[model samples]
Target: MPLFIRSVRLYPVNDNETFHRRFSVNVAVLGSLNLDVVFHCEALPIPGQTLLCDDFATGPGGKGLNQAVAARRAGAETSLLGAVGADASGDALLSFLKREDILTHGVVTLADAPTGVAHIVVDRDGENSIIVASGANRAVPADRLATAGLQALVWLAQLEMDIEVVGGFLREGRQAGARTILNAAPAIEAARSLFGDADLIIVNEHELAQFSGVPCPAGNDAAIEQAARKLMVRDDQILIVTLGAKGTQLVDSRSSFHVAAAPVVAVDTTGAGDCFCGVLAASLAQGASVPDAVRRANIAAGIAVGRTGAAPAMPLKDEIEAVSNG
Candidate 1:
């Protein structure tokens, strides 16, 4: 049985200032918030090798924060449900979310754990390698959803926090009649158990391969589709495989199709995937069909890759509209 059975209506927004007030759709994000330390280098160093080049910068990021920013910019009434430390870094992150117009009432502050951090290195080609310290992200209580007062049309999450917490959040969203989307990123084996709770699952090729126990070679559409099919838990469960420059592949019980990527010069692919997931959830909340939502998300991700940083790179509603309509 499908969890959600509400009437879908598309709401178009012409003004960014009043977009949230004009639309009834709401998207709640359950994930991690991190302070990102980015180092630019000509190329990533091999094991046991020492190399340094280019520049270093810092910003507010994390899958949760990035997606929340993306969703707000993409024109959804967005709220972030996560935890951060009661430190200056956490304060800055919360302020950043508020500045982006995303609701932060659901974001809790914990005094024990410091804010989470991600050490990222970006190569010249925009490819990145990241190491994360969970910190306050893991401190988010599983029961927080019960008291969050979220009236969401869509519930989106990632794997940056505890797997059990993510599962609990998705389960609650399902019971609440909101469409749940699980971005099984940084692919973990524990996330497989939560698949049954998700209405839609998004993953990269490597994640698809990991969860499906199949070889999903890059750019191999046939292989990717075969892998995606193995993970579909219900007749209506939709699976989206993000293939970087190759674009997005969507698989469901009824049918499967590919949405071509937007052509652009890649500068930094740090938050491209997060951009895609956030915009896709926002579009779905706005009542766009699966295919249309995927197309919009693909375009947004393409725009993100052309810029630097994660949360900052996400395209605005007007920018996405201009490119998508063009």
Candidate 2:
């Protein structure tokens, strides 16, 4: 059977000031928070080789933080449910989330651990390679998730935090009658066990390959569909495989289709995938059909890749509509 589908209109806002009260749908993100240290280079360094470029920046990131910000910017009543260090980095992250009007009540501070961090290298073509240091992110207590009041209509989960913790949230969220969406990033083998808990699963080509243990198709939609079919154990579960500039493939037991990517010049691809997942969850919470939500998310992610940074790069609902209408 197809998932629930409803028509949702875009919000009209002059600026970020109106995001909090503008949308009716509520969403909660359960994952990790990190400080991203980014470096730009002419080309990726070879072994024993060093290259330098002018751009260097640091900003708030991690799958959880980025997705929460993206959902909020896309006009959802968003809350971030995760842990941060008790130091300055955690304080700064909380301030940023509050400034965006996303609820920080679910975010906790841990005294014993340092904040998580990521070192990212962006090449001239907007391609990136990242290495993460899972600091305070790994310290998220399972009890915290159990205690948080996740009254939202939708709950989004990712792999940046402990996989078991994320699974627990997904199970609990489903029991509460809230729709659950899982974005399986960083390609962990354990994600395979949690697929049954999600009403929808969003992943890139690589993640799809990793989860299914099936080789990803190379530029062939038919082959991708075949591979996706092998991973669908339940009739209700929807699978979305993001194909970068090539767009995405949507798979369900009833039907499968492709959504084309929006045209845009690329600058940084750091959180483009995260932008897609966030907007999709927010759109679904507002009752959008799978195809409509995926189309809007494609546009939002295209806009994000044309800019830099993760959370800061996410496009608001109006921005997505502008490009979508044009």
Candidate 3:
């Protein structure tokens, strides 16, 4: 059966602000935190072989953490709800978030559960393979997250937790009258439950298939759009299929619109999708309809892909706006 969903407006996202309280957008992220250990290889070494890294760094990451920081940098007052180990990696992660200004009040610190860490290998061209040791993150016990008064609730989840936790959060957001957006990354079998509750399902070309079970475009945007239209409320709920340089195709309750990608020589595509979704959520909280928000997000993503590293690559609001206005 088709996922049960509600209708969403189709107009292009507008760049404006409408808040229940303040000027900035407010967003809550229900997800994980991780310390990213990167291996900068010219090319991935063969299995059972060793490849040396030319450069490396450790930083705060994981879809939830990346998206939260990106949203905050993009001008959203964001909060993160998840667990982290009390290790040195956890300390640095918290410190970095403090610098970025995301609400860390809700982070659960576990002494024994060592903070989650993702071992990543990225080739010179930015293609990557990652394995996550979801230490503290796996503590996703099934419970409804307390939803106070946030403009939106987002889930950048990995299926490291029970599906009940995901379901509980969605229900909590609905109860609190917040826009519920899910950035279902590393799409897993249980992640399927997200569609029914999401106001917007942000997907890359590969992830779109993982969710909709529909094959991504065999060739072009038209094929992809057709596939996306099959999932969720194609004409109602927001279905954004990001096409890298090809830009994005947004389908809503009425008609679909295509936003052209801004040109940039990509140094690292890591976290670009998270940047886009983060901006999209922030822009939506700022009262931007999908088109305007997504247009601006496309520009923001361009800025992120132009640099290296995950969190370090996200551009600030002014920088993103400058590129968007250009």
Instruction: Give the runs in model 3 whose Cα sits over 4 Å from its true position.
Output: 1-25, 143-161, 233-235
TM-score of each: 0.91, 0.90, 0.85
lDDT value for model 2: 0.84
**Whose TM-score is greatest here?**
1
**Residue lDDT tens for model 2, 143-187:** 654223346789899988888898999998899789999898888
Ranking by TM-score: 1, 2, 3
**Residue-wise C-alpha lDDT for candidate 1, range 19-132, written one tens digit per residue:** 122223378898899999999998987899777876788898999999989998998888787889989999999888988988776677877999999999999999999999
How do these models rank on lDDT, best leading?
Answer: 1, 2, 3
RMSD of each: 7.0, 7.1, 8.8
lDDT of 3: 0.74
Q: Of the candidates numbered 1 and 2, which has the greater TM-score value?
A: 1
Clash number for every model? Answer: 0, 0, 8
**Across residues 67-98, which tens digit of lDDT does each residue of candidate 3 receive?**
88888898877877777887888898889989
TM-score of 3: 0.85
CA lDDT scores, all candidates in order:
0.86, 0.84, 0.74
Candidate 2: deviation at residue 89, Å?
1.0
Worst 10 residues of 2 by lDDT: 15-24
